[model samples]
Target: MNTQLQVKNNTNELHHILTRLENESTRKEDLIIPARNLMFHEDGFIYDRSSNKIDGYVLNEWATGQFAQKTNIPSKYFRQCPPELKAVNANHWIKELSSDEDWMLRTMRSRDGSPGVVRGIMSDKYVPFDDIEILNILDDVLAKFNKDYEIEMWNRGDTGCHLRVTFPDLTTSVGKLTNGAPDIHRVGFHMMNSEVGKSSIRITPMVYRMICTNGLMGWDTNGDVFQQRHIYLNHDEISNRVTGAIGKALKLGDNMINDLLKAKETEIENPYDVIDQIAKDNKYSQKLTGIIHESFDRERGNTAFHVVQALTLASQTLNADSRTEMERKASQVLNKLVVGL
Candidate 1:
């Protein structure tokens, strides 16, 4: 007797097949993991997510993001890279095949935005030096390249060291290089800010560099291969200070001008109050009284110029003393306004 074979379509069978396919794909193809999970070996090779595989390692998205952030590279470009490929490409070790460190030194010096080319000399016989010592050597080599720019070190996450150079123009540029390697890459921007009425402008600049090196064990690195710098202006604070200065200058009026001069040695809360008291005691004109009242009203948006214009129009029908006082106050306020700007 022959037996017939039956096909099973059970939920458990379907789930098992799907899980197997996922595992196979992940194992065969490059698996993209978060930067936080990455662990670097002593030889400079990175550990893959699966302990069994050496090639399937995680990449540094945060380092790449830091590069994008400092260089002002568009977010669209970073997002364009495949998530797995981005991780691998960003975190890969830089292996220097050539015995000549000239290429690396020339690249860093030329990009430093300094006056001349900077040359690097090998201090020790070892191919892979300590990351900290290498950074110090790079700093010394680049220092002669740009005397006007200030160079500093930056560390982005666990990736590597960043060489930041600030220029006199208030602009900064960062050089991104692997922490312990000599490979160099760069990125950054310029920024400017100014008060609405101020004559001066504040500027800031940034740059980036990336470094990598090869040796017997593999590639080792130290600093950030990416970096950024920016300048900020407090516009609201400037405006407030200007407004206060203008208001203080307006309180210098004839009725209180003498009193103010007399009490200039003393600190008075409201200068306008001194003027108002004098106007009431001397039976000042209604137009003058109205002008003083209007000037003192903090709620009104009337600038000193507007107050003067109104006073001038009403002065034609008022006494000489009141007219002269309004004209004097208006002139003083106008001068203050122009100078404040």
Candidate 2:
């Protein structure tokens, strides 16, 4: 999926991330960096004092990713080079390729205090939408649902931020579990936002599988996808859309449930052949394909639903980004594999 997942989807884990963001919101600083005068180092970059910026921030993985993309360098390959070489190449490209454009580097205070991680990097026009604000608005709207809903999960980090909420009372049964109990899916909405261009602010329908804790997002199937770009967002408009999103998503949840039921019945005679095809079509590495193959074996169900189950089950163990990607792939495959789809 284009939307990268985040670590540990729980209220407490994300609350910690939120606390950090809150602290940064008050102490955060933004600087306009001119590529020509930015000096690259092994772990961070320095902005020349002439630009009226006297400090530079330590580069975290997120910051490195931003720098790599702006300079058109693969982060893995760039990091593999010797420090001296990395600095030279980074500076060269930063000057040659991005000199004409200015980048806003957002930073938070470090433990020892001088300046810390690069929280965000973007152009001057990137709008600053505080994660705390988004969550507060979302919480208010969710309370109006009045259905004993639970904030299912949350993700807040430099990479991106996300929120998922589900109503336990709002669930539907699909196939049978191994113990013969019905497989239940609960409906809710998945929300994501990234002020630094990690992702657009979006609200979409979500289906959560109770059996394996798998999530399927972006399946409104019958309503508007409320996605607002950071460049232009009205808080009131977003609140209205988010309120409407949950109701619309719940109403259409049955449509997705029916589709999933059909997919469960649609058998895949040659699962290996299908798996191979997906790997090739998506250009997934042999290593990743092998893992999926193993997961499929573990699932041992000869239907398209099993294929999706394997992917999501595997995702629970993967890193944040990889897990999101696997979930997205599973959703896509399920859509394509459904009968009469």
Candidate 3:
């Protein structure tokens, strides 16, 4: 006997495939980040979301607003910024010009027939640095440490430019408490412009979370960063400074490796205790505390390494200044856990 084969509906199959393709093509959500609002104060200063004040003196409201617009920070934040945020002083906003005998200012009649004192000329020259030049400098410096160094990401906007370079050769993985859960370390360079209204380059020592690929950048030591002024464009000086910074960073990285190894060996049955201690010892924000708790809960085991990783991930969510403070506190907490060991 001969059997007849039945064919499925070709039209229906084609329609289903087309629908799936369409869904895949339009799945991405459009995300828009708003510009930061910088506040301008009557006393001539700008402030971001922090309580600290920027060291800029505005001679008039028009100048202050111009500075605020240029800086792009909210007016409220700048006005309410606290004194602690104030640096001793900075000439970042000020510009110097050479005296030229040929240049002369046109005569201006003062309002109300009164003579006004000359306030001097505003600077017209603003120094510019090529982003590529800065990256080349980083490339030269990072190559000495790791030949495999490569730029992982690049971001730029009104805030300024940011380049993240990764060093695959200088990585470390350690896990003694949980045999399968090894925390990985990836060293890199995070070079950027307009970091706190100044150009800077730094050794970005970030840890990789085993579960999630979050680059925990809460451990940027003071010794790792080098800030430079645009006006002082000295390649030799910058190269020398970068060389010294790299040496210090290598030493810091070695110490971190040792500390992480110790952390892996140290056991903690209840990781929440560490989180609680950290929260109490250092007035951590609710958001930071919440992230820490989540990190501990998500971690597979109770170990000092996991606790440190958790805290590190939490610190990344903080604002620029707060992240630095949290990283220092986390370091202190981790150190306390393995003081003798």
User: Which lDDT values do the candidates have, in the order given?
Assistant: 0.30, 0.71, 0.48
Clash counts per candidate, in order, are 42, 0, 8
Q: Using lDDT as the measure, which candidate wins?
A: 2
- Every model's Cα RMSD, please? 31.0, 4.1, 17.3
Top candidate by TM-score: 2
Per residue, candidate 1 scores C-alpha lDDT tens digits across 211-244 of: 1110000000221111111123243443343333
Q: TM-score of the candidate numbered 1?
A: 0.16
Which window of 10 residues has the lowest lDDT sum in candidate 1? Answer: 211-220
lDDT of 2 by residue, 228-296 (tens): 777776788878987886677776555667778987889999988998898899787888788878889
Q: Evaluate model 3: give its lDDT.
A: 0.48
- Each model's TM-score, in the order given? 0.16, 0.82, 0.53
Tens-digit per-residue lDDT, 1-341, candidate 3: 01111122233332343354344324211111111322334343433333332223222323333333444445455435453332211122211212231111111223354432111112223233444455556556655654555444444432245544445666777653345655566654445553123344444444433344434442432533566665656777877787676566555555666777888778997788778878877877776688899977766667787787777667667544455446555565666776542
lDDT score, candidate 3, position 221:
29
